[model samples]
Target: MGKREQAREEAAFMRGDVGVDGAATEEKQDAAEVERGKAREALLRGKAYLGREFLTWLLWRSESGEPVAAFEKTGLSVLFLGRVVLKGISGDVTELSARGAMAPYSEQVRQGMDRGLLVHQARLMLTHGEKAYEVTLDAEFLDIRAAKLPALMSEEDDSRTGERLYLAEQLSAMITTLVEAFIAVRAGRTWSKQVVPAMKEWMRGEEGTRKQTALQRAASARKR
Candidate 1:
């Protein structure tokens, strides 16, 4: 076979789109593509919890009144800001959003979390060492949206551009590291034995607060 013809056959083989003896491959290729797609769908559906849990855990940590995490011996600070979105795969109310300056620690966010919804997306203010970043984080895709980086220290055009790039890369790296840190802890036995239990305790506290708020509202209603 000539080089071009041989190349075409090899490419087709690599794609699993054809076989020897020139048998028709349309239906077979379509079946294979459908099977691959199904596998991908199943994988994503089953594994989506990891992202949700990581964001939820981060939000829980944020409520401790201070940034309370360290990575590779460096202190890191995370604050949920602007808007927080909580969602579950299946529910009567599948999604909820809390907004504004104090939205991160608001009663609605906590109550939603207590009800077993995970954080699907949230705005985050992150500090790594001395640098700060603001980003809206989407859990399922790990997307860093609407990012704000620290101010540049350079004035010259080339130098300023370089610094900006550096800051952007740093922002991305910090987020990736944070995700890796969460995954490590999640995979360890500590997640079940210690972490999850602690989170449940936090949730219980929220429930109590909600009950108290309900009582206050009822009392005020009666007075009115």
Candidate 2:
């Protein structure tokens, strides 16, 4: 072959190699994108699941008239969820509650979460978190840190303290969302229906023990 012919052949070979590399790179990028989407979906699903369980717990507790215990038990989880909603919607916490018990938030972001939670609280109530916990949540006074839902369903590891703090803020926001739902339900029920189950059921375990103690005391007194 002549010199020009050989040069042409070499160029063609290089072009073919480049074509194969490009195709592989594209495939890799597509696969990565797919994985990311799946991860995002999983995260959302997990949050929803956690939210539901918390709501149920709250419901049961409220019905039983143990709101304070319910609050303490699910406090952290609510904080996490609140933070997520806040972060996702870019809303405020103070508007939900003037209580300084929440993580700090910017004026703009607090407003966003407040608005978003007010709109989304009903769906969230029907979907997740404990029943009473949701009731305790209020959109106007929502805490961004109070909804710190566990990331187990869609664990998003925050590599930094700042990220964790952000998560805390979202959790608080979620709690406010629940509170809003509770108020709506309360108003609908005319605040007369038992927010919890029969008070007897709520006091069952402790009251039972107390009764037993009283009976024993009477027996001892008779013997004396």
Using TM-score, give the best candidate's number: 1
Write one digit per residue (lDDT tens) for candidate 1, span 1-224.
Answer: 89999898888877878867555466644644564454345434645666788889887776653555665578777777668888887768778988876675666777787787888888887867777778888877667778988888999999999999988887887776777666656656577799998887776673343323323322432343
Alpha-carbon shift of residue 90 in model 2 (angstroms)? 42
lDDT of 2 by residue, 1-224 (tens): 99998686667667663353334222344644564455344434554433432343343232222222223235322221122122223443422322221211223333443343222122121112432122233222222223323333334555555565654555455554444444344334333455333322323332232223323322432343
Off by over 4 Å in 2: 1-162, 196-201, 204-224
What C-alpha lDDT do the candidate models reach, one value each? Answer: 0.71, 0.34
Give the runs in model 1 whose Cα sits over 4 Å from its true position.
Answer: 1-47, 65-68, 71-73, 206-224
- Model 2: lDDT equals 0.34
Error of 1 at 16 (Å): 26
lDDT of 2 at 168: 53
